[model samples]
Target: MGLITPIGFFSIVQKPSDRTHDTLTVRARMRGDLAALK
Candidate 1:
Protein backbone atom coordinates (compact mmCIF):
# COMPACT_ATOMS: atom_id res chain seq x y z
CA MET A 1 0.00 0.00 0.00
CA GLY A 2 2.77 2.41 0.83
CA LEU A 3 4.62 1.93 -2.47
CA ILE A 4 1.39 2.10 -4.42
CA THR A 5 0.53 5.42 -2.82
CA PRO A 6 3.60 7.20 -4.22
CA ILE A 7 3.10 5.69 -7.66
CA GLY A 8 -0.51 6.80 -7.72
CA PHE A 9 0.42 10.31 -6.63
CA PHE A 10 3.13 10.50 -9.26
CA SER A 11 0.75 9.51 -12.01
CA ILE A 12 -1.84 12.04 -10.86
CA VAL A 13 0.71 14.82 -10.92
CA GLN A 14 2.19 13.75 -14.24
CA LYS A 15 -0.95 13.16 -16.25
CA PRO A 16 -2.08 16.74 -16.65
CA SER A 17 1.31 18.05 -17.71
CA ASP A 18 1.62 15.23 -20.20
CA ARG A 19 -1.80 16.01 -21.58
CA THR A 20 -0.99 19.69 -21.91
CA HIS A 21 2.23 18.97 -23.71
CA ASP A 22 0.46 16.69 -26.13
CA THR A 23 -2.20 19.28 -26.79
CA LEU A 24 0.34 21.96 -27.54
CA THR A 25 2.23 19.67 -29.86
CA VAL A 26 -0.93 18.78 -31.77
CA ARG A 27 -1.95 22.42 -32.11
CA ALA A 28 1.43 23.39 -33.41
CA ARG A 29 1.31 20.65 -35.97
CA MET A 30 -2.15 21.72 -37.09
CA ARG A 31 -1.07 25.34 -37.47
CA GLY A 32 1.91 24.31 -39.52
CA ASP A 33 -0.30 22.26 -41.78
CA LEU A 34 -2.70 25.17 -42.27
CA ALA A 35 0.15 27.50 -43.13
CA ALA A 36 1.45 25.03 -45.67
CA LEU A 37 -1.97 24.74 -47.27
CA LYS A 38 -2.17 28.48 -47.82
Candidate 2:
Protein backbone atom coordinates (compact mmCIF):
# COMPACT_ATOMS: atom_id res chain seq x y z
CA MET A 1 0.00 0.00 0.00
CA GLY A 2 2.75 2.47 0.85
CA LEU A 3 4.66 1.79 -2.35
CA ILE A 4 1.58 2.02 -4.46
CA THR A 5 0.70 5.45 -3.14
CA PRO A 6 4.10 6.93 -3.99
CA ILE A 7 4.05 5.36 -7.42
CA GLY A 8 0.62 6.78 -8.08
CA PHE A 9 1.76 10.23 -6.98
CA PHE A 10 4.76 10.00 -9.24
CA SER A 11 2.57 9.10 -12.17
CA ILE A 12 0.31 12.07 -11.55
CA VAL A 13 3.27 14.41 -11.37
CA GLN A 14 4.81 12.90 -14.47
CA LYS A 15 1.70 13.30 -16.54
CA PRO A 16 1.62 17.09 -16.17
CA SER A 17 5.37 17.42 -16.66
CA ASP A 18 5.02 15.58 -19.93
CA ARG A 19 2.14 17.76 -21.03
CA THR A 20 4.00 20.95 -20.14
CA HIS A 21 7.04 19.79 -22.04
CA ASP A 22 4.99 19.08 -25.11
CA THR A 23 3.25 22.43 -24.86
CA LEU A 24 6.57 24.24 -24.63
CA THR A 25 7.86 22.41 -27.66
CA VAL A 26 4.81 23.32 -29.70
CA ARG A 27 4.89 26.96 -28.57
CA ALA A 28 8.55 27.23 -29.43
CA ARG A 29 7.94 25.91 -32.91
CA MET A 30 5.02 28.27 -33.44
CA ARG A 31 7.06 31.25 -32.26
CA GLY A 32 9.82 30.36 -34.68
CA ASP A 33 7.37 30.15 -37.53
CA LEU A 34 5.84 33.50 -36.67
CA ALA A 35 9.23 35.13 -36.56
CA ALA A 36 10.06 33.74 -39.96
CA LEU A 37 6.84 35.13 -41.37
CA LYS A 38 7.70 38.65 -40.26
Model 1 steric clash pairs: none
lDDT of 1: 0.34
**Model 2 ranges off by over 4 Å:** 1-29
Model 1 CA deviation exceeding 4 Å by range: 1-29
Candidate 1 structure, TM-score to reference: 0.23
lDDT of 2 by residue, 1-38 (tens): 11233213111133466776664222223344435434
Write one digit per residue (lDDT tens) for candidate 1, span 1-38: 11233213211133566786764222223344435434
Q: What is the lDDT of residue 18 in candidate 1?
A: 70
TM agreement with the true structure for every prediction: 0.23, 0.23
Residue 17 C-alpha lDDT in model 1: 62
